[model samples]
Target: MFKGNFIQNLPKIYGTYTGGFLAFIILMAIAENAGVSKETIGILFVAFTVCIYAIIGYLSRTVQVDAYYVAGRQVPTVFNGMATAADWMSGASFVAMAGGIYFGGYTYMAFLIGWTGGYVLVSSLLAPYLRKFGCYTVPDFIGTRYGGNLARFCAVVVLALASFTYVTAQINATGTIASRALQIPFELGVWVGLVSILLCSMLGGMRAVTWTQVAQYIVLIIAYLIPVFWISSSGNYGIFPHLMLGDEVAKLGELEATFGLKENSKEAMAAMTFADGSPVKGLKYIVNSHAGVPDGAMAAWKFISLVICMMVGTASLPHILMRYFTTPSVKAARKSVAWSLFFIALLYTSAPMLATVSKLSLMDPSLATGIIGKSIAEVQSIDWYQAWNAQKWMHIQDFDNDGKLALNEFFMRGDIVVLATPEIAGLPYVISGLVAAGGMAAAMSTADGLILAIANALSHDIYFKIIDPKADVRKRLLVARALLVVIGAAGAFVASMKLTSILGAVAWAFDFAMSGLFFPLVLGVWWKRATRQGAIAGMIAGLGSGTIYLYMVKFAENANENIILGIDHLRFGIIGASVCFVVMVVVSLMTPEPDKATQDMIDEVRVPSGKTVLGKQH
Candidate 1:
């Protein structure tokens, strides 16, 4: 059957999340004696993993390097969509995005809106054209398009900057999931994940990752949907009777209001500012719980920077762009994106439901309780406002000994929801283990792909092209494998730090890609006048501007407006992207365009006079 499917058989994919996932099962058999939640975790440990090599082996015995890197560039449209969805919806999408909406209000929906909406641009404007080039990676496209090694080198720099920055965060997410699911040290969990990715992906390359990701997509979505379905069924079973997400959204809203805020949470969602009622700017005025955290105090640039990263991020992402190459045809490439969005919607819709419901759960004192502030007895009832602070991983602080939690006292972890869901939902330990496995799936799948992409660039783009043009395939693979280990270790080192949220780390990488490279790449592809000088200049300016802008937004908050074109990230991205485009155009007007040879190649990529070409050979 579909041995490529990991969820259908977990033992196969065990090495992907770490052999620890398999080790988790043997330990689960002894869990009762060990005082760990056993059966549920054991079922999940078994059910979610697969004997991946066995399944893949059974699926296809003989394979070529082409299949490893690009699934032989002939994956079916629907399957490619599912696999890409899995790749696109990495750990950041699975874990941090919803909690983002939770704390950020409606603003965070931009993740879905940006990523989803951006696909329209991808499929219509970029993906099919890129596929027409018949390249294995983004750098390959750049190298072949301009027929210049310098162009390829620039693309490599931009892609590496965007992808590797996120590699650590994904590894960190894997480790966190492991710590919760298996009760291991956070650092050890990361090591296990790193080893798993290095083993499965380095040896197999894209050939292994594509099949594994397809299987994982199935596993990840099922694992996610089961818990969500359970929550929905427990609340209102009728909605699951073949209804779609919109109707389900209405049902969820009703369920949330069906139970009022726990008495303690009456103070939630305070206003952002008060212009009419505030007469005193001094301490003599009375402050009510209803009064919100005033403006001019909150971190606005953080919000701006995050949105900038996301809006500009997806188009340039290496793993994401590479998936387009796997489609059986350029037409398949376009069709797969629609499918990718459809599959992605499955979880994205549920994510908001989970966040809203979790918010409700946190507010319900009965489920969340034991203590509030300094007194366990103080708010003996449910209070959404007060309980919101309980959601904080950092802890609540009360200054001046008043025993009241100020708005600033509350600090929450983005990953906390995914990790803490076991205790929060009152689910068994097994479910927690399953969730951990899910996060690991997201992390390792992405990590493996990223590490492979990095290795390919170094070995093929730099080494084979420059150092030894006559390098054999075997030697190239050897060099690629060696490079994988180096990059994997670097990723592991960063993941072990475990400081930022997976979403935040991923977002940072996206900002670099979106702002620095999207403009240059897009213009280089379609614009007739895009000279190499223009392309190089745009890349430098886009990359430099985006980088400096991010540091300003992150570090020198006081000068955010002064430093960054004084706009929101969404708006600023438009500005930064435009800056790249305009600079490229202006520079190109002053210089000669690439020779007619380059122009002819551009025309070939742009004007497809016939159906998409598709095939594979070994």
Candidate 2:
């Protein structure tokens, strides 16, 4: 009865929590206006929000295997949608997405389109069916569907590779936010973020992550929206900036022209130098450059290929698919996907507005005009410049030897754009603090889901299912918790190494997932004839081919000259997925079909009205 009431009243409960959080923000704003130090406000914002999530994690802790694995399969639809949205946003979406748009212009909209469109694939093709199949993990589904340790083990490998890569990006995002908010080194910030992430997920697992993500979604969306709203209302763009993106973008392009920031302009292509007289590598800033593709002839192909990878990858990602397993039923799972899309759209639609307005804020002559012609000493003395400069996020060197700064003389890391926007716009320090907390929440929420996905795959699929099928719940839970710590620490270490930009790493993860798992998972559900042998062969072929291509393009000299159909590293998934489909189809045709029982189970998954096929296992 208590559980029933708790679930029934979740909407009201979260509403009250949202209201209280707003009140807290208001109080903090008041403190800031009353002369509270910026550092203190930053610390307070991060500390307060993290403590709240930690407390939720603590309260939601469960020792039961079912709850730990799948939130006892009782999560409400609306809250689950919110949790899924929080999990989906990640550090890449919150921190680096706008920056990607600001730098790459219309080309980066592929990400927004692909990611959002992926959820439609989820709703129609995967989510409800997976819920009906009643799996705790994606690997669990693969293991059960194909009926072999080898197939399951292969799935776990793919899950680990993709989830680990994705988690590192999330940790990188956390490190970026922490370095700015806490004034710590980026390396130390990675561990700091890891600790908060572990606190939220180490105990109750899925249940803890679910509730905490709801809280995070609130913070992240509010944090994301406030500054955009503030900046938009302050400008001629008005309060609803998303509707005015065209005007703002046109204005931004004008500023780029005024500053000679066009991609083809000599000023943009000029060499630059650091403050220490060392030559800075390549053009760091280009107005409206198409990302990854070189020739105009290949732009459409590259764009379409990228969208395909992201869309399929979205469906293939194990951490995301696992969200549907927490829902109460297949019907609820489908509904949850709809709600997830709605929640996600709120942020997705606003990202471009944030990007356009943020760029305008820094460029508009009526607004941050001094930057283009300002003397080095003068610009260095500005508060936002000094703060970001201290962290090495922004740099300026008058490469032309003029005392005043040229547009090309300035360089800023794209990862810091969202985090530094409030400060750049000269908003209250409290808003910066709020954005930091929001960024942390975004990173931590995704990290929690991703780490859980990896750890669960190892503990449940590899350890318990294959090595010790007789293991008790306690032992299984113990193994999972321990793996969580190890995997998270490993991710933090990789993140500290700074392998790639946050968005770059995320794209790689998506491509990797799509390459290896998309065809197998989709085929497993939709094509009953997909034999275990075919699935295994497809996984190896797809992942192996994609990985080799990625290595060549990224590491080998002259590799770009031979790229197949202009498929760069970001679009390797297209080739891999295509190869997997062909290989899987051919192999399955050559192999014997699945036994009748397996075919029936596949049929059972498609129906929406029955109890979960594997529900009794728990």
lDDT of 1 at 546: 63
lDDT of 1 by residue, 1-618 (tens): 336653344445433544454455456546745675554564456334634523542453223657655767767787778778878787888877656655554556657676776677678767888887677678777776656788778878888887888788877876766654555688887776777676566666776777777767766776676666665555343346235344544543443344321222223323211223322111110111111222442345444444555655777777787888887677788899889889888888777666554554443334433232324225323343244333334333332356643333333565555555544656655555566667667776777778777787777778877678887777777887789899988888888886665666776677667766786667767786778777777777777776666566655667555544345333434445667777778888999768988787787777655532222421
Best by TM-score: 2
lDDT of 2 by residue, 1-618 (tens): 235677787887788889988998999999998999989899889989999999999999998988999998999898999999999999889988888887887888889999999999999889999889888899899889998999999899989999998999999888877876787898999999999999999889999999999999999999999999898887667878877667767666666666775333454335455555555443245456322334685787777888998999999999999999999888899999999999999999888888787777666657653376667788888888886666556777655677977666677877666888877777888888898899999999999999999999999899998999899988999999999999999999999998776666889899999989998999999998999999999999999988988988877899888587878888888878888889989999999999999999999988988778786455
- Pairing residues by index, what is the TM-score of model 2? 0.94
Error of 2 at 282 (Å): 9.4
Candidate 1 yields a Cα-based lDDT of: 0.63
Instruction: Give each model's whole-structure lDDT.
Output: 0.63, 0.86
Model 2, runs deviating above 4 Å: 1-4, 262-271, 276-283, 289-296, 368-370, 373-381, 397-406
Per-candidate TM-scores read 0.78, 0.94
User: For each candidate, C-alpha RMSD in Å?
Assistant: 8.1, 2.7
